[model samples]
Target: MAEGILRPLGSSDLRLSPLGLGCWQFSKGRGLVGKFWPVLEDSVIRDIVRTSWEGGINWFDTAEAYGGGQSEEMLADALSALGEAGRGAHVATKWWPIMRTAGNIGKTIDERLRRLKGWPIDLYQVHQPYSFSSAASEMHAMAKLVQQGRIKHVGVSNFTADKMAEADKALREHGLRLVSNQVKYSLLDRRIERNGIMEAAKELGVAIIAYSPLEQGILSGKFHSNPELVKQISGPRKWSSGFKPEALNRTRPLIDRLNELADKYGASPSQVSLNWLIHAHGETVFAIPGASKPHHAQENVNAMRFTLSQEEIGELAELADRSKR
Candidate 1:
């Protein structure tokens, strides 16, 4: 596959690969949420990171809450192992907002910088909107970090449309802009489109950072073809309705369309799904798909090598809309 293209993230000077490597799985199953994934070997983690960097992925997204900050440390270690090769990679990590006031944003920013070995953070985000402090307060804190030169850009995740707008206004008060909103967006989950989030993002000029672009591998057509494989899934995915036989049956037509497109584009079903996202709304959308293995990273980068036709994109969108109804 050819090298992936980099694009501007919202109105920021920071450029990101159309596809980013998500480091949530690097937690190695250590934290409360990390227990859902099987422990991965350090060598495997390094390989995945190395592969992603070499495969043309320039940005990585991780969180402080992911495996209790282990994900940040592991990502740092993996990138450090690359020496000069990883120097230009942009790293985006989030601050967990649960049970904390806006003041905690600055306090935790120090810890996140420490855990990342003092590497510059390209985009620092509030992981979720469930905070004791108001959105305005939290964004003001994030804007402060940007002023301090700790984070290049400020972002948020899982924020509602109104809250996103409020956060943007708050950041503007500090002479900054909310660059992105990271949320779960995929062919299977299109809540952002129905809800006001997508519209707000476009109106506010904030990029939508799409996580789980493959719908936790459902769009890959793995569990649908082999129901037995669903038993081996760990974490919250095992309990997802998408893994159920009936749900799979209901989605068969959509999966079939994805597969058909995959064949036409000479790509995998997951690639087809991810490509759809990056091309969905011009440059307004980006995808961060996790790579548990080296080849997974390679496959993800390859997704950008080809572009889907407008007609093909429309057809897939129609299928997805019908499935939802």
Candidate 2:
């Protein structure tokens, strides 16, 4: 572990390396307007997970909704492989909030645990706040898992500030507290800061897990000069409003500056992007950047070893602040 980089997930026993491996992309293909379809095969995913573990990514995240349970199976394979190699990695997964009824809460936990194949899941989260029917019952079920040692801690994802507080209050009734909130917080997406999500999490001592910390590779200088490549990678969603060419245009200056700084630091654009997040965001804040290639995985692991200067952090933040998207 790199000294001074590991940070505790507020109030939880779990300590995550600054850069975690986001396994969602291994199973879910990418697209510009939206994500691509037809998830990767089990063997391909297993290889991705193994590479991630070997690259010092001790923290891996997945969700039950990913590839309709295939993601969990893939995670299990990686966990088993890591255990065999004596790596003993940590895993975090999520439960879709649509299945929050009392009758299904306990069963859902059991099914997720079963798919994990006895590897202790460090964190289990509610994927979204789709519904809150029997919130008490659902929280209690999670509490029961902690008691049974099936899950180490509880968390929430894509939750609003208000919903996060409510969940925390309800879980506390059962003597459980949510340790983190996994939200999309990056230079390109600052909605959390404006919407009070950041403030609430800080006040409640919940760690913010920043997914898409590279802004879907936008911050890595890949799409800076090539609008056509951006469109090609965006797939059918290219026509979607979210995949507009204007967004790519907005990122050019930041991309150029990132490249310049990356050269100075002897790192890739991806590493600079991750380092920028760590410095501009809180020390408790951690990012999970997805990588489909082995070299990409290696670059991500190397990102944790460096520090961004205060001046560079501010310059990058200002550059992003000026970006429209």
Candidate 3:
């Protein structure tokens, strides 16, 4: 497939690849919740980064909480090895807002920068909405960082519709706009669509950064064809109902539809799943699928190589809705 296409990121001046490389797996399951997967070799990490960059992925998403900050360091190292070419890549990292006040937002900026090896954070976000500080105060803090040139854009993850609006209002108080809201959205998880988050984002002209666009690989149809692959899964997903035999059997209709569409488009089921997200609500949605290997990275970028028709999209949406829990 050809290189990925770039689209405007909400109201920001910045542009991003429709599909971004998620770096959560780079933590190799080390920090807090990092043990979901086994640790990977340094060589393997570098190759994944290189493959993602060469595959036309301009943005990478990571977090300070991931692998206890190891993920950020690994991402920085991988990009640093690319030298000048990597300079153009956009890095998005998040601040863990647990048991901390808004002041911590300012205090931790330098540390995040340090972990990223001084690379400018293109999009800095609050990993969650559990900070001791008010949403307004946190937005102001991030706005201040933007004004001070510590970060380029301010975003949040896992925020509700009202909370997201509040954050945008607070940023506007500082003459800034909330550019994106990172959330778990896929064919399997349509809560964002039912909840007010998706509508709020569109109403406010904010981008929806979709994490787990592949539904933790459940939508990839891998486990269905090879049930043995279920044992190879790590972390919470190993025991999640989505991977159970009955759930897999229940979701067969959706998987079969995805496979049928993939064959028609000459793409993989994973690619079809992701493409549906990119065109789901015009260009307001973007996906960040994790890539632990070079082939995974390449396959992710290929998702952008094709487009699904409105009829195909509607059919898939129906199938997904039926398969939802």
Give the number of the best model, judged by lDDT. Answer: 3
Candidate 1 regions exceeding 4 Å error are 1-3
Tens-digit lDDT string for candidate 3 (1-325): 1356789999898889999989988886786678876788888999988888888888899999889789999999999888887788999999999999999999989899999998889999999999899889999999999999999999999999999999999999988999999999999988999899999999999999999899889999998899999998766778788898888988999999999988988889999999999997999999999987789998988888889999999999998888764
TM-score of every prediction relative to native:
0.97, 0.89, 0.97
- Per-residue alpha-carbon lDDT of candidate 1 for residues 1-325, written as tens digits (9 for 90 to 100): 1256889999799988999988889988877988867778899999998888888898889999889889999999989988986798889999999999999998878789998996789999999999899999998888888888889999999999999999999999988899999999998898999999999999999999999898879999988788899999877878988788888888889999998988988999999999999998899999999988899998998898899988988888888888766
Give the TM-score ranking, best first.
1, 3, 2
Error of 1 at 144 (Å): 1.2
Instruction: Write candidate 2's Cα lDDT for 1-325 as tens digits.
Output: 2233467887887767777888775445433211444456666666666666666667888887775556677778756765567356788998876735645656787788887787677998877767556444556778888888878898888888987888788789878787888999887787897899888888888888999887766777766666666657644534544346776677778888888988898998889888887667667578888766567777888787678888998998888888864
Q: lDDT of model 2 at residue 298?
A: 78
Better of 1 and 3 by lDDT: 3
Q: How much does candidate 1 score in TM-score?
A: 0.97
The lDDT for every candidate, in the order shown, is: 0.90, 0.75, 0.90
Alpha-carbon shift of residue 18 in model 2 (angstroms): 1.4
Better of 1 and 2 by TM-score: 1
lDDT of 2: 0.75
TM-score of 3: 0.97
lDDT of 3 at 182: 98
User: Which candidate, 2 or 3, has the higher lDDT?
Assistant: 3
